[model samples]
Target chain A: MDFAEICEEKFDINRYLGLLCHPGCGGTSVFMGTSRCTSKISDKTVKALDYTAYVPMAVKKLKDVCVNARRTCAVGNIVVAHRVGYVPVGEPGLFVGVSAPHRQAAIQCMDLTITAIKAGVPVWKEEVYEDDTRAWTTNAECFWLPKPPTHSTDLPQK
Target chain B: MDFAEICEEKFDINRYLGLLCHPGCGGTSVFMGTSRCTSKISDKTVKALDYTAYVPMAVKKLKDVCVNARRTCAVGNIVVAHRVGYVPVGEPGLFVGVSAPHRQAAIQCMDLTITAIKAGVPVWKEEVYEDDTRAWTTNAECFWLPKPPTHSTDLPQK
Candidate 1:
């Protein structure tokens, strides 16, 4: 199953783990998002971040990722969370956790889940730089975007 | 920063998070590994697991992943932990956390870190199955071996 929350309260790692844990699973993967002290736009540092999301759409997309991962891999329970409102530097702003019957599947699924979240989920952020500069950002224009795929036809198939 | 440990003590989620959290980071991705109730070998169910690692090599590889990820992405801190000895089903077996200045970088680094751990670390496992059947297992010939590269082209990118 998939779950998402926009909370102001401090996120609990154990609690989230417990929620995503399953006796049939062997791995649980988690990711947490935090505000950074440095800003790329300017030399100034960042104090906090303001995050927003199209809740319904974002939730639907998250569930879709969970379902897709479970179907493709041997994964079990899953949880995805993103914080709204203001998040101070170093505080967790987003979290994604997944469980599977094996370490490989869990790790791969969690990785895919986060990548999908960044690419598909309707979450937006505004960086609050220390020098009082602010601007909105999305996954599409991020500096960390994965490079374009390269085609290769040289492999010995089993 | 980079950290790696194999502990017999209780897994402290909060303490792990504290180490991973950094004011210089804007995103943190974590992956927690847990024991499973099902065994792939036979009808026997799994009750718990014991993990052992080639400490020096494991630590070196983990640190390498952390350093490479930090240099390649906007990531800050990377923390990875694996529990050794008597991990009950549904209990955490490992945790990998990554903090970065952006969500994409954090996610990407986390994905790379976990993948590297699975592929490069020389860790072994002993599974205790239901009916008291026990046996040791290695990545050699395991169904999950030979992990794919961390680049986006390897998997369905986003």
Candidate 2:
């Protein structure tokens, strides 16, 4: 069985693990999208993030990801969740969990599923910066964006 | 900061997430190696698994993985844990969590770190099967091992 949906509640890791676990599976892979206090836009310090989604389409694509992974790999179970509304820095806004009876299947399917999510999922994010500067991003653009330039004065060093 | 260590206690997912969470991080990738009731060895079914390690060397290599990841990627924090001792089916035996300022770094570093662990880490496992059959293996051998062909009687059908 698999689960894919968008919710506004804070994620419970253990709960997701419970949903993903299968006695026949040997490996589980998880990817989380967490809000950052720093942004790749340079000179910006993020305080939180706001997430929105076209619920019907987003949910449909998320399920399609699971279905596609299963069609191509020996996936056991999956749980894909994307949170809507406010997400503070250091908090997760998205989670993908998958399992397979073998390591390669779990790893391969997970990588494939996450890539699919980033490429086509309808989820969008608006970075709420410390300086009140804000920017919106699609799931795809965030990964390909330039790295945030580092400075000597960036707070909470390392 | 980064963490890598072997433990005998069951993993608490929240604790690991706490260790990996950093305000500067926008993405976190997690991979869990769960104990399976099924094994690649045909005609056998796993009941649990027993793990062991050469602590000094294992810990050293684990730390090296983190250092290597940091050297190559803009990783914010990492937490790698491999549990020793008995692990029942559906329980996690290993976890690798990483976060970065951007999604690519987190994803790339996570993929790299896991591959490194499977390729050379000193951890070992002995599969305890339900039919009284047992087999020992190294971390490297597990992933490359031949997949067990599926049969109609596979229990707990997905």
Candidate 3:
């Protein structure tokens, strides 16, 4: 079965990847975003990343993104999870896995799903620096546009 | 450190992913091509995929692809390995992982690397069907051609 959830503890890529394996699928594509030690903006040393979300809305939105991807693409199974709270440097904050009858669909499913999440998810992130400072940051995918426009009305057309 | 090798035994995704976790990198992208039970051509159930390669040349070419990617992209560490011999359905036959300062670099690196492998690598595969039939197969990426042209002189310009 497909899986999606918000985890407070660290997430597992192996478990997620395992969920995408099916007898009908010929290819699976996966992407992971981890907390890095260096800040892209300032190049400062990073210690951890703090993530939070409006739980109910975030959960619903996350599932919607996956469902939409399945409908638009020729994919079979999908498993995606996001972590909340503090994610240490070098630790993954997001995991997305997709399975399809062929490689192209699988890869395209991941690409579309990731873009959707960045544009729609309600998750918030704060970068904790080693210099005893912290900054709330937007996902790099849409960082230039202040806080992303609220998704309630900004949702992709069905 | 970067890694590139050909494996007759099952290679570890966890091991390869672990190799990509570095303090300086904010993102790591990974792609795995597994032996699927279904064939896109006839929709037949697959039992296993038997792969063969000129070990010396295949190994050298694989490393060259990775080296070329590292030189061209903003990615940091990379760990890639291809399987030879038989790979059962639902098991990965190829794995590519790359770490970079941001997600874009990591993702693009994987895309470029996969394209290069499918277009240039000399691995051959035979599909074993559950009904006791077998057919030598070419990777789907370039299946329109009878067989991919020899890459002996097809290496990308350095």
Q: Quick one: best DockQ, which candidate?
A: 2
Name the regions of candidate 2 deviating beyond 4 angstroms.
A138-158, B138-158
Clashing pairs in 2: none
Per-residue lDDT of model 1, residues A1-158, tens digit only: 66766565778767787789899876677767677777665566678887877677767777887777778777777888877778888888778887877767777777777777777666777777765556654455434434422221211235
Q: Identify the runs in model 3 with alpha carbons over 4 angstroms from their true place.
A: A41-43, A140-158, B40-43, B140-158
Candidates 2 and 3 compared by lDDT, better number: 2
User: What is the lDDT for B73 in model 1?
Assistant: 73
Shift in Å, residue A77, candidate 3? 1.2
lDDT of 1 at A145: 38
Query: Where does the lowest 10-residue lDDT sum fall in candidate 3 chain B?
Result: B148-157
Task: Give the clash total for candidate 2.
Answer: 0
The lDDT ranking, best first, is: 2, 3, 1
Native interface contacts kept by each candidate, as a fraction:
0.96, 0.97, 0.84
Top candidate on lDDT is 2
lDDT of each: 0.72, 0.81, 0.80
lDDT of 2 at A5: 82
Question: B4-123, model 2: which lDDT tens digit per residue?
Answer: 889889997888999999988878988888888766655687888888778888889899989988899998898999988999899998899998887778878888888888766777
Ranking by DockQ: 2, 3, 1
For candidate 2 chain B, which ten residues in a row score worst on lDDT? B145-154
In model 2 chain A, where is the ten-residue run with the lowest total lDDT?
A145-154
Q: How well is candidate 3 docked (DockQ)?
A: 0.60
